[model samples]
Target: MKAQLIEGGSFQDSRGSISFVNDFCFKDIVRFYILENSEENKIRAWQGHKLDCKNFYCLVGSFRVSYVKIDNWDKPSKALKVESVILRASKSQILSIPAGYANAIESLEANSKLISFSTLPLDEVKDDDVRYNKDMWLLQ
Candidate 1:
């Protein structure tokens, strides 16, 4: 069980965007997740995994990624909205995420595909991936 954390700064080499790759301890049983951002899951809570690590690559357009520390499980931490950046795959930039932090990407374009990969395969409702109400986290 190996845990890793890779941020956009290290992976994204684009002048205005970001991307990266990460290889964890998992030799097999990796899970691939394709997320299409819509109005429903616009605002939410994401917690880092215990055993799984992630890699994010921008197939098109750009996004604004943010993170927060988990002081209270119910309360949303500070809103650390990163600078809005563009990730053009033509430049070959990718974002890699390790297992320690929570992250969310808001699409800058109307229709964009942010390809993300993870090593641990599990359901979204599992203990590894936890999401809370954005508004709910603030009050806690």
Candidate 2:
């Protein structure tokens, strides 16, 4: 699995400053997800889609987007490489993850949020999602 970062930035005007970001291109965006992690509610990990590659962007605050390649599913102890990206609203970066990869999200701030852009629709994503334990890939 490979991860690509999309460039993003902010701008200002006479009235007030504004921010904007673009991926250059995102084809067939079928779904959007807004993930929030807070003290009352915590998330170690979530579902990983088999049919869709997701693009992650931190709308506010900061968090860690972790991913692992699932090419070798038979051998759980095969020592697959785990990759991570720190997403922050200040930096305004978008991370694109391809299919066949498992993802885990960790919130670094109190009220952190992540917006996910999916290639597949909700129905397909539900059927194709492969749920993995956070303990397996998440750092203790």
Candidate 3:
């Protein structure tokens, strides 16, 4: 029900000379994914996992990520709280999203990219993901 930002720096990984830290203490890594946003100021919202958690690392360009707390299943759109952050390479940070929280991502630059690590595998995550209208939480 919360979002965490962890500071990271350059390190060696299978991806080569990337500004990443190969460490995860929160949860086991079930999968990794890279997402691309081809246009600037574009929004992608929203999705939430009932059991899977997520970690986000910026690989290219920049974007804004928003997390809204969904306290219970009774009202998925009723967020107990909302938090947002800007992600960019210069910041060298990673975002941790807990399960039960809905998230929205917006690209601030064209071709923005991000690497995400999840606690659940593909098939399991697909079914657990809950979707909503893009402007679902815009008014609030």
Candidate 4:
């Protein structure tokens, strides 16, 4: 499956605001973690899964999320096209990344926090995890 954004919205009426992604389902999510980048412009790059899916949501500040479809599991092409999107706390949305793609995240602001939802359990993550250098694919 291709990566897509699950759009969401918020409601406000003097009692503050409520943000939600109604289209995001939790049935396949077996694990989750909050990723906080201490410094701005720092990149966490080139991590992927072959059998697991991931969903990312910006909880605080802003981020640039980039991904590339893997051409080969053992050795992906360095020239693969990279796609990216900006996720901000002001906008409530979830970026769903399916299997077979490598992804990187960069914080646009200091102390940016993102929540990642995964389809695989903690025990199976190690075996399915794949990593590459931060410079594997340039993000635009």
Candidate with maximal lDDT: 4
Output the lDDT of residue 114, model 3. 86
Tens-digit lDDT track for model 1 on 1-140? Answer: 22223323343345665433433333543666655577555433455454456666667665554454444455445553322234554545445555645655666666667777776766643867766545432321
Runs off by more than 4 Å, candidate 2: none
Q: Global lDDT for candidate 4?
A: 0.93
Q: What is the lDDT of candidate 3?
A: 0.78
lDDT tens digits, residues 20-103, model 4?
Answer: 999999999998999987664489998988999989999999999999999898988899999999999999999999999999
TM-scores for all candidates?
Answer: 0.58, 0.87, 0.82, 0.96
Error of 1 at 85 (Å): 6.3
Model 1 ranges off by over 4 Å: 1-29, 39-47, 69-86, 123-125, 135-140
lDDT of 3 at 139: 26
Model 3 C-alpha lDDT per residue in residues 31-137, reported as the tens digit of each score: 89888875554787888888888888778889788888776655664545668888896668888998888888887788889888899888887788888777768
Judged by whole-model lDDT over C-alpha atoms, candidate 2 comes out at 0.77
lDDT of each: 0.52, 0.77, 0.78, 0.93
Candidate 3: regions farther than 4 A off? 10-18, 77-79
Q: Write the per-residue lDDT of candidate 2 for residues 1-140, one digit (tens) a residue.
A: 57788888888789887666665467778889898976865655645666798898898899888887786554454367888888898887888988878788888888888898888988776677777766776542
CA shift at 107, candidate 1, in angstroms? 0.7
In order, what is each prediction's RMSD in angstroms? 7.0, 2.1, 3.8, 1.1
Clashing pairs in 3: none
